[model samples]
Each structure stands twice: as structure tokens, then as C-alpha cells.
Target: MSYVDGYVLPVPKSNIEKYREIATKAGKIWREHGALEYRECVADDVKSGEVTSFPQAVKLKDDETVIFSYIVFESRQHRDEVNAKVMSDPRLNDMMDPKSMPFDGKRMFWGGFSPIVEL
Candidate 1:
């Protein structure tokens, strides 16, 4: 089974371009470190639900939009190895600082998952 790392964050509309630039660089680094796939997607038609939603999950504001991203690896062990290299990569040093991010790092959420099914 494949292992995945997923992320959800709210980015201010004004910072979308900056966010995209960072994501592009990070995605390249992740892939170079052995990630099979890296994708970053911005919200298009998502809406807030009464009970729960992408917007609610990230505590989105009117000036912000949700970004959903994921990185795919061959397996859990593969993911760990790739991530270890990624964290130590010099190219990502500038992006490692939370204070420099365009979004609120405090509200961002991420998790690793084992895919149940893929068809």
C-alpha cells in the first residue's frame, strides 16, 4: 500500500502567488528526495457547511482560501526515508521557518495516512 502525507491550510488571497512559489519549490524538493507525487491544489468550489467543511476545518476567513496538498510515497518506510532527506536538504532551509510563511502555520494541519484503497 502507498503512504501519503496530506496538508490543509488557509492562505490569504493576496498571498496566493507567493504561496504557489513556495509550494512549487517545496514540491520539487520533495520529489527529488523520492516522493512519487506532489500536488498542491487551491479551493475552487468549496463552501462552508453547517456542520463541517474545508473552510471550517482551517478556520478560513473571507480573505483566505483553502489549500489542499499531498505527497505520495511507495510505503511508510519509503515516506520516512524521503522525509528525512527532505528535512535536511539545504534548498528547503529558507522555507523551514514558520515566521516566513505566507499563511498561518498555527492553523495548518497535516497527517500521514495509509491508503485503504486505490483504483
Candidate 2:
């Protein structure tokens, strides 16, 4: 089974373009380091639900929206190896700063998932 890392977060409407630019660079780096896929998606039809939903996951604000993204890896070990290289890559230096981010890092949520089932 593949390993995955998921991320959901809010980005100011005005920062969407900049966010895409950053994500593009990061995605390339991840793929080069062995990630099977690095996908990013902006909320297209998110709506509030009874308890919690994608909209609520990032505490969607009036001026901001959610970005749901994921990265697929061959396995946990591959993820660790690839990420270590991506993190150390000089090409990603500018992205390491919170101030340069298009979204609020404080509100971002992410985690690695071990695949239990996959068809």
C-alpha cells in the first residue's frame, strides 16, 4: 500500500496565485526526491456540514478558503527519505519561512496516513 500525507488549510483569496506558485515548486521537488504524486486542490464546492466538514476543517474564514492537498509515496520509508532530501534542498529555502507563506501556518493541519486498504 502507498503511504500518504494529507494537508488542509486556509489561504486568503488574494494569495491563491502565489500559493500555486509555491506549491508548484514544492511539488516538483517532492517528485524529484521520489514522491509518486504531489497534488494540490483548491476548494471548489465546499459547504458547512452538521458537525464538521472540509469547510470546517480549516476554520474557513470569510476572506479565506480551504486548500486540500496530498502527497503519495511508495511507503513510509520512502516518504521519510524523500522528505529529508526535499527539506534540505537549497531550492526550497525561500519556502521555509512562515512570513513568505501565502497561508497561515498556524491554522494549517496535516498528517501522515498509513494505508489500511486500497484497490
- The candidate maximizing TM-score is 1
**In candidate 2, how many Å is residue 114 off?**
1.4
Error of 1 at 112 (Å): 0.7
Give per-residue CA lDDT, model 2, range 1-70, as digits (tens): 8999999999999999999999999999999999999999999998999999987877888999899999
| Candidate 1: residue 78 Cα off by (Å) | 0.3
Q: Indicate the worst ten consecutive residues by lDDT in candidate 2.
A: 52-61
Q: Please list the Cα RMSD from the true structure of every candidate, rounded to 1 decimal place.
A: 0.7, 1.0
Give the whole-model CA lDDT for all candidates, comma-separated.
0.96, 0.94
Stretches > 4 Å off in candidate 2: none
lDDT of 2: 0.94
Provide the lDDT at 81 for model 2. 94
Task: State in Å the error of residue 18, model 1.
Answer: 0.5
